[model samples]
Target: MPIRMVDDPQDPQESNNDGGGGGGNSNFPGGGGGGGLFNLLPLLLGLFRGKGIIFLLIIGAGAYFLFGRGGGGCNMGNLSDLGGLARGGFLDPKQFERANIYEPLADDNTKNPIPEKANLMAYAPAVGNQGEQGSCVAWSSAYAARTILEASRSGQQGEATKFSPAFLYNQIGLDGCQGSYILRAMEYMTKQGSVPYDKFPYTDRDCSRQPDQSLIRDAGAFKMRGFNRLSLGDRNDAIDLRAIKENLAQGAPVVIGMMVGPSFMQGMMGQEVWQPQAGDDQMSGFGGHAMCVVGYDDSKFGGAFLIMNSWGPEWGRNGFGWVRYNHFKYFVREAYGLEPMPKTGAAATAAFTCEVGLVQVTQQGNKMVAGSYAPLRSISNNVFETVSPLAIGSRFKMEVKNSTECYIYVFGKETDGTSYTLFPYPNANDATKTKYSPFCGITGTRVFPHDKSMTPDSIGTRDVMAVVVSREPIDWYETNRKISSNPASDYASRVNAAFAGKQVSNVRFQSTGKGTMQFTTAPSQNQVVAAIVEITKR
Candidate 1:
C-alpha cells in the first residue's frame, strides 16, 4: 500500500498540520479551522430550501391562473352584440330621432310686439342695492310681454303695454324675493300661459292670496282645482307646454313702464305727471293704479309703444291700456328680464253641440233620466246610442211649450204603472211658471199629434217627453214649490227646484241605438237641471 501520512494535531512547521486549528481563528470553519463540516452544512441546506420554496410558489401560481381567472371573467362579448336587436340599431330610436331634429325659424309676419329673444341688458336697468325694486321692475317687463302676446293671439288690434299687475302678481309673489318669483313665473308661463281656472278656487274673501279652507269655511266644500272645475279638456301647466309656445310664437306686443309717484296708488292718480296723455285724467277713473300693456303701435307714439290696464274685461277698455317703448324697456331691465315662453299648447274645446228638439223626460221618485228623440240619424241630429253616451251630471234646459190639456207629472221612470204611485197634476198649478218649466205645453212648433185619430194627415205625430232621473224618494211638495217659485226666470230653475234640496250623486241618459237620440234642448240655463227619460239599453 502507498504510504499514507496523517498530519499532527498541532505543528507550526508541518506542511500537513498548517497550524490553523479549531481555537477561535478566522480561517476556521465550524471550529476556527478550514474545511469543517459544520460550515458546509448551512450552504447545502440553503440551496435545497430555496429550490423547494420556488417550486411550490410556481405550482400555486399555475393553479390560481387556471381557476380564478376562468371562473370570474365577464361576458363582454354578449353585451356588445345586443345593439343589433334594437329597433333602429339603438336603445331609444324615438328619442334619438327627435334629438337631432331641427325646427324652422318662426315667420316674421307672425311675430308679436315683444321680441322672440329678450335682451335684458338693452331694456332693463342695472341692478342696484335695492334688489327688490329691481326685481319688481323686471317682473313688470315680463308681464308686459305676456299681455302683448295674448292680445296678438286674440286678434285684438292696438298698442298694448308690456307691463301688467295681473301678469306681475302671477309672475312674482307679494312677499319679498321678487327676483325668484319672476324666475318661477317666467318659467311657468314659458311652459304654460293659461293657469287652470279650477286650480285657483274663488274665495269669499278679497282677491289677495290663494283660496284656502279659511276662505271656504262658510262656502260649501268644493274642489278649488281639478278637471271638474276647468272648462272641458283644459290641461294644467304640467302638460300644456304647446299652448305656451303657440302664444309666444305669435310675436305679441309688450311695454314696460315706471310709475313716478311714491306709491302705486299715487302714481295712478297722476300726482306726479310723467308721460301725460291728453285724456289720461279721464282714463284714471278708478283710484291710483298701475297697469300693464297687451299691444301697441310704433306710428301712434312716433315710434312703437305698449298698451296697459288695471281692471279685467269688465273694466278699462276690455282690461287694457298702453305705454311708451323705450321707457318700458328701461323699467324691465331695472327689474330683471323677461322669461322665455313655455313650449306647451292650447286647451281643447268641447266637441258636442247643443240643439233644441223634443227630449223625453221621465222622473221616478228622486231620480230623473232624459234623452233626445230625432227621426234623423246623423251626429247633429241629436240622436244618442249605447256607444255615443251623454255626459253624466250634465245640466239641461227643459221647456213646456203648451200645458192647457195634459197635466205633466215629470216622472223619473215609468214602471208598468204599478211599482210606484204617480202624483196627479204635479206641475199644473203653476201655469205662469210653465213658461220657464221643463213641463211646457205642446206648442205647434214642437208639438205633434199624440194619436192619428186626433189630427188626420198630421205631418209631425210624435209625442215628446222630458225625463228626469234620481235615486232618492221624490218629494211632491218640494217639487211643486220650486216649479212655481220662479216662473219668470227659466225652465232650469223650475227643474232644479225639485232636486235642489237633495244631493245628486250622478246623472246619465239611457243609450239610444240611432244617433238621433241625443239631447234636443239647448243648454241656456245657469242652474243645475236635467231632462227625464226611461229606455231599455240594447
Candidate 2:
C-alpha cells in the first residue's frame, strides 16, 4: 500500500548557474537534465508567483501608506527625530522635577529652546548722579555688585535681592578717587569682612604706589609689571572662568574696566557738544576718566578681558561697554587701586521701577508752535531728557508706547524744518530695506494695538523730552496722511480738516502735559513732531 511521490513540473531546474539547484551544477550550456529555455520558463514563472507579483503589491501598499493616507515618510532612524521622543538617552529626572525647566514641553507646538535662566538682570539704580573722579571706582564697584544681585533674583520668587553701593561703601569705610590706589579699598573691604580674601593674595605694597613711568616708555613693560603684581585670587586681578561662569549663572555681578590716556578727553571734546568736527572717532571720546573692571566678555575673549565704562547708560551703549585683554593692568598701575566697596543693609532691599519717556514739540521763530503739540512722559522713575532745541541736521529721541509694548525711536531733523526718520525705526517693520522711508506719512506714525498694547499706564512714571529745531518747509502731504491714518484717533477729521489744503508754513506748540504734547512747526518739521506725538502711549 506504499505509493511513490512525484516532483512538480514547475519546479526549478537543478543547476548551480541557474541559482536554483538540488545537487547538480548548471555550468554546462546544454546539459542532459534540461534545456535553457525550459529552465528559464520555470524560473520566470516561479519568480512571478513568489516575488515579482507580491513585491509589486507590497510597493503599492507602501506608497498608499505614505502619500495617500498621510502616514508620513518612513524615517526609521533615531527616535529623537520623532517629536518629543528621547533618542539620545533617558530624560533627566531633575529636568522634569524642576518647575521652571522644560516649560516649552507643556505646549506641543513650541519650537523655541528653553532658556537657561528665566530672567536677566536689569541695570541697577536705573539712574544715578555722575560720580566724581575720586568716587568713580567706589561708585562703579558698588553699582556692579548691585546690578549682579538684582539680576540673579529676577525670575525667583518674592522681592528681588538688592545691593546698595552707598551702604557697601560705608561698611568698607574706604574713600579715595577712582584713579587713586585700590590697595586701601581692598584692605578695608577685607578687614570689614565684606568679601573673603582667601582667594585673593596681594600685599598692600603690590598695589600701594603708582608706577614710576617717567622713564618707562614701554607700554609692554608697564603692562607686565602691573599684571605680575596683581594677586591671583583678587576678584579684580584673577580671570577666574569658573567664578565668572558661576556668578553669571547665579546672576552675580562681576566688575570690569579699561585704561585710557588724555587722548580720550580730546576725543570727547572733539564732539559737537564739546567741539564740533566734520568726522571724529566716537569710541575714544568716552571710556576715559577712570578705571573700572565690572564684568568679563563671554566670546573668544572668554574671561580674558573685562567690561568697563566711563559714562553712565546715558553716555555709552545703555551704559554697557567692554575692555581689552589685560587692559585693566595699565589702569590699575596708573590709578593704583580697585573699585570701592558697596553699601550694605536694608537700603539694598529698596526697590524702584525704571521707566523711560519722550516728548516732542515743533518750533518756529524761537517759540513752540500750535497743533504741533506732543507731550510724552513715563510713569516710572528712570527718565533721560535728550539735549533739546535739537539743532538742524541733528538727532532727537522718539518714544512709542502701547499698553503692553514700548519702543524708542531716534530721528534726525533738518535746519529748514524738514526731518528724516532714521534707521532703527524703519528697519523695525521690514529688516531688509536698505533705503530708509523718507515719506512723512511712512516715517512719522507709530501704530500700537489697544488690546495687549503698550500704553502710558503700562510704562509707569519715567519721562524724557527732546525738541527739534529746523528751518525747512514741512512736507504737508506726508504729515497729513500719517495723522489721518494713525491708529490712535481720527487724524483726518481732527488734524487734516483744519489745515486740509493750506500751505502750512509756521507751526507752534499748543500744550504739553501728562503723557502728551503737541507742536506746530513747518510742514517738514511737523513730521518729527508727529513722530514724537505718536510715541506717547496716552
Candidate 3:
C-alpha cells in the first residue's frame, strides 16, 4: 500500500499495489510491473479495438465485489504536524521511490511584486481537520466544492454550506480510511450529490458508520454539475501547472496531491517555511496526500502556491501557508476545478422528455415453442429485434444460440421513453455463471421482469424497450441497485437524460461469422448478437 499521509505516520506502508511500495486492500490492475495473469488477456484483447472486449472482461471476471474488495483500495494516511518545503514526489502511485534526507532549500525573501494572485480563503468557509482518518482526498475535495458552492450563491455569498465528506466516504463505494483517488472524489459529487454537514457530519474513518433516515433522505439531493480536469498528456507537469494557475487566478479553488515526508511534515507543523530544491524527490517513503491549492503568490519565495491544509485553523497561518512552485508541481499529483450544479428555482423544476420508445419482453415458459416466436433471420445491424410487443410486469426468458460463452443483458423501457436494466439483480450470479440468464447459455433459464412502474403523472401508453447488451454495464448496475431488484421511475429518468443519443459502436458484441462457418445467421460481414423486443403490459 502506498502510504496515505493520514493513515499511519512513522510506519507508512503501501496500501495496495499502486506500482509503488505500500500495502493496500483493493487490487490495482497493473501495479508493481506485473498485473498478474489478468494482464495477459487484456493485452491480447487490446489488439482488437472494440467494446466487445470490455464486455467479455466483465463476464469473465465474475463479480469482483463478491470475492475481494471491488475495484482497487485506497490508503489514507493521518497527517499529524504540518511541514515546510522539501522536494518530493506527488501522489504518483506508479513511480520509483528513492530515499533522501530532509533539508531547508530556499529562503522566503523574494521582493518582486506579483501581478496575478487569488486567495480562495476569501470565498471559502472555515478550515476543517481530517482527524485520525486517511481521508485527506475526501476532506479537501468536499472543502473545495463547498467553497465553490457558497461563493456561487448570490444571496448566501460567503455563507459557507458544509457538505458531508463522511457521506462520500461511506456511500461512494470507496474503501474507508484508505486513501482514494482525487479525481474519483470529485466525480462522486457529480454522480451522487453531497449534503450539508448538518445532514451527515464527519466521523472517524470506519465502515461501521451507518446512514440514518435524515442522511438517506439527503443522499444525492445536491450535486456538482461537473468538474474540470487540469491534467495534461502523459502527466505533463508544465501543461498542468499552467492550467492550475489559470483556474486559480479565476478564483477557483483546486484540489491537489502531494507526497508527504519528514520535511513536508515539518513545514505543516509551522516549524519553518518549506523551500524544496530540485532533484530531492522522496517518492518511496510516505505515500500520497491530498490538499487544496487556494491561492498563488508569484513573488513569494521564488513564486509559490498558497495552500489550505485540512488540519483546521491552528495548524499553519490559520490553516494556510505558501509552497514553492517547484514543490507544487513535484508534490502535487492531480488538480481539478469544480463547478456547482444549478440550484435556482427554475433549475429545480426543469423537466426533460425522451424521443425514443419504451420496450418490454416476457419469457412465458421453459422453452420457446416453435409457434410462439420466430427465429432471427439475420444479425446484420448492431441491434437484433423482435416484432412482438412486450408488456409491463411480464416475465421473459432469453436464450442465446450457437455460442455458449456469450453474455446477455435485458433492458426495459417505460411509456416515458426510458430504458433500464432488467436482469442481473443484486447478488445475482456472475455473467459467466451457468445459473444466470443472458450471460449463461443452455443451462440458464433465469427470468427477467418489467418491474419499472409508470409514474402517476405519465399520460402515455406504457411500453418496455429491450436491448441485449454484450457487455455488463457494471458501473451502471452498481450505481442504480434498483435496476436489478425493482426498476424505479427516477432511475429511468436519470439514465435516459445522461445517455441520450450517446453513440456506442465499440460496445457492441463482435462474435461474427468466420471463414465458411458463419458465427451467426447474419449475412453482414460483421455481427453483433443483440435483440430489442417490444414490451407491453402482460
**Strongest candidate by lDDT:** 3
Ranking by TM-score: 3, 2, 1
Please provide, for model 3 over 1-538, each residue's C-alpha lDDT reduced to its tens digit, 9 standing for 90 to 100: 0000111111112111121111112222233323333446667587656887787668546423111222121132323323322121124322211111011101111211113556666666677777666667777777555555556554344435667767776654344345566666766777766777767678654644867767665756676655554544222231255445545654557777665555455545653246542222422234556788877766565567778777666666777777766556545555665543343564332221101122122223422211123222223433333334333223333322222222345455544343445444333355222212233211112223212222111234334334333322234454233333344544334433333343233332332222011122222221123344322222
Best by TM-score, which number? 3
Quote the lDDT for 196 in model 2.
16
RMSD of each: 37.5, 31.4, 21.9
**Positional deviation of residue 408's Cα in model 2 after best superposition, in angstroms:** 50
Candidate 1's residue-wise lDDT over 389-462, tens digit each?
A: 22322222222222111123342211111111122222245532221112211111122111000111111222
TM-score of 3: 0.44
Instruction: Give all candidates' CA lDDT scores.
Output: 0.26, 0.27, 0.44
Native-to-model Cα distance after best TM-score fit, residue 528 in candidate 1, in Å: 52
Could you give the candidate ranking by lDDT, starting with the highest?
3, 2, 1
What would the TM-scores of all predictions be? Answer: 0.23, 0.25, 0.44
What's the count of clashing pairs in each model shown? Answer: 99, 79, 68
Which lDDT tens digits does candidate 2 get at residues 277-332?
A: 22111111112232333343334222222333434444333443433222233222
lDDT of 1 at 254: 26
Write the number of the candidate with greater TM-score, choosing between 2 and 3. 3
lDDT of 2 at 435: 20
